[model samples]
Target: MDKSFKIYVVVFLLLILGYLYLESTKKQPINWFPSYAENHKIPYGTYVLRNELKTFLPNVTIDEIKIPPYIYLEDSTRTGTYFFADEAINFGDAEFFRLMEFVKRGNDVFISTHGIQIDTLNFKTKRLVTGNLDEKVFFKFYNKAFKSKEFTFNRAFINQVFTKIDTLNTTVLGITGYVNANNERTNEGVNFVKFNYGKGNFYFHTFPEVFTNYNILNTEYEQHTANILSYVDSTKPFLWDSYYKTGKSGISSPMHYLLSSKYLKWAYYMALIGVLFFVIFEGKRKQRSIPIRTPLKNQTLAFTRTIANMYYEQQDHKNLAEFKISYLLEFIRTKLHIPTTTIDETFYKYVALRSGNTFEDVEKLFKFCDEIHLKNQISMDELIKLNKMIEKFKNTIQYGRK
Candidate 1:
């Protein structure tokens, strides 16, 4: 590599580091997912709220419970405030009845969501849009503590408007609205409401995102949530729900424990990656290439040709004939599995039966073989005749077997 190129690479890496540092220092975007679980640290997660509650209410014990409201309160132990946060609360009739009965036992319930209805507390939500393309709005608490002071939020979202209120029992906690296209400041509707159920109170707030990390980090917005939480009974233990929004209260299994921890999880992943790379590189290095195999050269035809050439060059007709006769007898003994040491009528009959050849062919082939073996110097014509008879006998036996 060139010296200038190396310098360029170093400068590029430094720029990346600078950019990452700047980004980490900057505020993150608003996460709108409803995850009330304490493990999540995103903008919408209640992790900061849960921790802050611990500091603010040191005397009270905050428990994240996942069981149903009825089952959780069945022990009749100290009754405390139940806090439920989500996008919406669509409780079934049985659950709704159970929660109502639980609240009847002098236990308070605080629910924060976009909109919900419980018994007499009917909440009708609407969205208010103004001159701006993004529907951004401002809201203020209706209580006397804030003195009707308003604070503007940073992001644009659907401004939830509470249209109906059971005025006899419900009190408006906070109000929100947006300026219309006509440049008129319009109070769209209420955003927070509280109702008296039976012996206890039910606090329902529409703007759940106010308690999120993104808004709670802001001094102005943080005070709003603190003020809202002040309404809860701090004298009793707090039951922070981690079940409704997400169906999980704690770690699911051993896999979750392994992956949730920072160092242990990273170590596990690095070990797996190391094993994969080891298998790849070590397999490549240790594996030996297979040697190429050539077929065994058949020397049967070559040996036959050599023998035939030698016999013809020496003009040894009698020797060639005797060799052929011996080869035929050996072929019958080995291939047909018969005794061929004797040459007689009994031998012919046994060979005909075992070799699957006719008796006449067997007899003729044996006679020719015996005559050739007895000859001292056979003529070329007699050797040729014996060869033809041997070949004919082999063909007859092969045909019969087939």
Candidate 2:
């Protein structure tokens, strides 16, 4: 090989080697998005919680629920806990009502989200967004049994406390909030509560991140998560919700496989880069440039407008009306497919039927045109009237079919 070709090959090889080295050495960043998907292994996902739920309560039969509460509740009737843990579970009107009914029928519904408020049921939530960086949130159970150190989370966790509740039916289960900077024992409000409804109970918890993989896997924080779930009656069936998650369960698309892994994603990108490089370097095979040609413009509408304007400016309404009548006849022949040999009863009948206009309207329009055609000099009013009638008839036409 020549010296220049050898140099080109060497450069290409170096580029490929450099790309491989970069790809091998690159470190993927951590994803901190609060997806709350039971399948995701991200920091805020509940994958660890879902996998270890059986170990936590071996007696409880775990069933994965992929459909919405409304559809599932309507189709089947069962006694179990409908467990939901997500960053947000904003139920629709119908779904929420259906869920309430399900709970009323003596089935427990455990929902853990950022906030909880059912104004109709005399339950409300209060939020606190004070810029307190040092103060931490203290989460502890109100029950004296299983007494342990209060679990604390950093300032990243905000407050969504239960501010109001029905005293007769509601019971505070846990208190979690900044409460007080100097004294964590002070009550800001309760973040966890239990409501005694019809025949069942509603367990509401605001700290959804406790159910996430991060907290559940943390050695120091794992016990806290267990403490929260201690309230669940595990002897019954446990329906683990796969629905109402921010990061939906299974996302399948053409790019799903490649994008799911960094290596495959980068490999696909490298292939695209190679194609682009080939187009830039080797695609120019000494082909001659093809000249660009502009298409001809149709000036039919402009020409018609110019003629109409000239006729109006010269006050030749008689001839202009005649011209319009002639064009109208031609349009009817081509568009309506009726012969212009005579403007008789049969012609009017056919035109009316095809153009979707009443027979009387069609007959009246043709009579007016005929009257204008016979006049030597027509008024501007008569010309305008003729134009209006013609336009109205054309607008009502069902075109494209013969």
Q: Which sections of candidate 2 miss by over 4 Å? A: 1-20, 115-117, 179-187, 286-402
What lDDT tens digits, residue by residue, belong to model 2 across residues 89-190?
A: 777555677778888888888999885447766878877554556566778788888574688765286568887889899888888756555765444568
Off by over 4 Å in 1: 1-32, 76-78, 115-120, 129-131, 180-184, 247-402
Q: lDDT of each structure? A: 0.74, 0.81
Which of the numbered candidates is closest to the native, going by highest lDDT? Answer: 2
> What would the TM-score be for candidate 2 when compared with the true structure?
0.66
Model 1's alpha-carbon lDDT is: 0.74
Candidate 1 TM-score, true structure as reference: 0.53
lDDT string for model 1 (18-124, tens) is 75557545765655666656667777777788789865566787888875564465465547889988767766454567677777788888888765665445656
- Looking at candidate 2, what is the lDDT of residue 130? 48
Highest TM-score: which candidate? Answer: 2
Question: TM-scores for all candidates?
Answer: 0.53, 0.66
